[model samples]
Target: MFVTESFNRQLDDLLERICSKLQISSAQHRLAQDRYETIGNWLGARESPLAMFNPVIYPQGSLRIGTTVRPCSGQEYDLDLVCEVQLDWRQVERPVAVLDAVEQRLKKYDTYKTMLERKKRCIRVNYANEFHLDILPACPDPSSGTTCVVVPDRDVRGWKPSNPKGYAAWFESRAKTFEVYLAEHQEPLPSQEPVEMKAPLKRVVQLIKRWRDLKYADDQKIAPISIVLTTLAAEHYGGQQSTSEALAGILAGIVASIPPRNQRLLVLNPKNTKEDLSEKWDENPDAYEAFVSGIIAFHQSWQDIARGRGIPSVSATLRDLFGEDLTKSVVKEQAESIQKARSEQRLHMQKSTGILSGLTTAGSVSVRSNTFYGSQEVLP
Candidate 1:
């Protein structure tokens, strides 16, 4: 599905086009939220055994931060949830009990019993069509202060500190620094509302994630996890007006963040300083190096897209960077959009290297095709 065959067109809108493709549609967002909410309600019901603990279910990870990428064509979208039971950490003698309890509760239901799959830290209830919920059983972390919880870690046979709420807040604070509004309406939910206009920082993380997915479609073990990428992207993101510029800056910053060969690059959770988000890197050093390589490759492909000339060449590079199907669809849509804008006499090329669709830049040139019955095309 490599698409560098024959289409001659400028690719100034490549990054913007890709951004449009990355977000979960409003309907998709609602559907995922609805499914998770149903389980959350079922778990917190008065009839449920855990009702006395004041259990609450809320989203974490990409969904929490409005950076959730639409999974590749037909891929399962993960909804990370914290099934927090209001109990002192000391109440549970063995930290594993909490996780066991959550799993046991879910298993009681015939439907959930079939869908449930126990992982090291969470119980995943996988839906058939491109969605799954990973619910981590946690208790209040009073020792660490607000919004911190201790979730059972099967690998360590103990509880690990996490602050998904705090982390989301921190991420949102960074995003809010640069206020942006889009005309398009975004789907909303109370706990973790998707962004109305995806901030440049969010877009940066999304683009990085999309690249990681495409890069590690088969080699997921080596693929950089979303948390690490999001943390680094947020830490490095300086408020840039343009999405492309923001992405470029974030990539450069991450590349710069890599440590010397002897030392591991440590990414600490912003909310819980004691918790290192990049701990997985310690388990597999090759994964860290692989992440570094992926970042470099992503940066190069992005740069190529920015400076791309012919549409076909850009399409091929995009297919290499993202996947073939997604790249093809986005490119086709962008081409149509551009064609429509041009027909309506609203198309204008940005003076500074980019020839965008429908946006009129200051000192912009009028674009037109020089076709006298199959003649050379005129430059804008």
Candidate 2:
């Protein structure tokens, strides 16, 4: 379903609310750790052995916690409590059964009920929603021979697993490093004292992730999102600027870019803003057109580079064409080099083909003319 303008605005508001709620300004690691510990205690009291789950039990589907280092939107302040368990769980028990167990366990917490219910379509959720916590459960595909996979909700069936251990270990280690990092940086912890990642890049990642989600939420394809992300990173961090400036600048761009369509996806205060935001639809047709057109351009540019049709330059004109994305430019340089290498290979092959063709023609002429019969200099 297409997200309406009001919903998009709501999502924007929601993002800002989350950022404000992230009380741990300095000790991000501590904030994350505290939340995990709170969740852990809740889980322990509710489901001990089952909740006592190790980060590596499944080797295939382990659990971990981390700051939203790489969110779909730049300001989408999020924390993930992910579980990567064995794929065999499906065959042994069933996906529904696993979901039921998780849902039941979550119900024990009054704070997690409402939010969990909203995610029912995505996963089995309950209620008492406060913080922005996402429970991503993943398992490997037994038949496909893949290592691990995950789906946002149990309703659909596609899984992805990137750094199983790293994800699961994030929760356990973030708190310690966050405190140390903050102390070193001379920043104050927020009143809430939330856990945060000590690494500066990780926060930047969260900002980028927020934009990614927002862009893709508008459309499933990733061209424009990739470009904008790359461009922003390059322009902000390319020279004398500090990582902090880069992060803040990117965050500003993302919040400013929220589409009007997203407004309909909002779950709160749906009635009040409907009329005013709706009129902007006709008023800002150009802006809407530009957003769509930008994505199309990004898609075409990427396709051209892939097919050896363009300059193979990623970060140069292509990024400027879209907006910004650090990933594409960094990857673009390598892609261009690879394309050049392949072109050289084709030239070498063509030269060899020409040599063979000439040899074949010369041999045929000599045979037909009967001038090669005693040519000993020709050597066999």
Clashes of 1: 0
What TM-score does model 1 achieve against the real structure?
0.84
Local distance difference test values of all predictions, in order: 0.77, 0.38
The per-prediction tally of clashing pairs is 0, 69
Error of 2 at 103 (Å): 1.2
Put down candidate 1 lDDT per residue, 1-380, tens digits, no spaces: 11111122233245556777787898988888888888898889898888999998999999888889888755677889989999888767888888888888888888887899999999999989868889988888868968898889999988888889999999998887556333233334356754355688887788788888888888788888899989999998887756767877887787777787788779989999878898998899899888877787777777776565466655687788767777777867755655666666677666665444455558776567422332222333
Clashes of 2: 69
Identify the candidate with maximal TM-score: 1
Number of the predicted model whose lDDT against the real structure is largest: 1
Off by over 4 Å in 2: 1-24, 27-29, 44-76, 85-87, 118-130, 140-147, 150-153, 157-380
Worst 10 residues of 2 by lDDT: 265-274
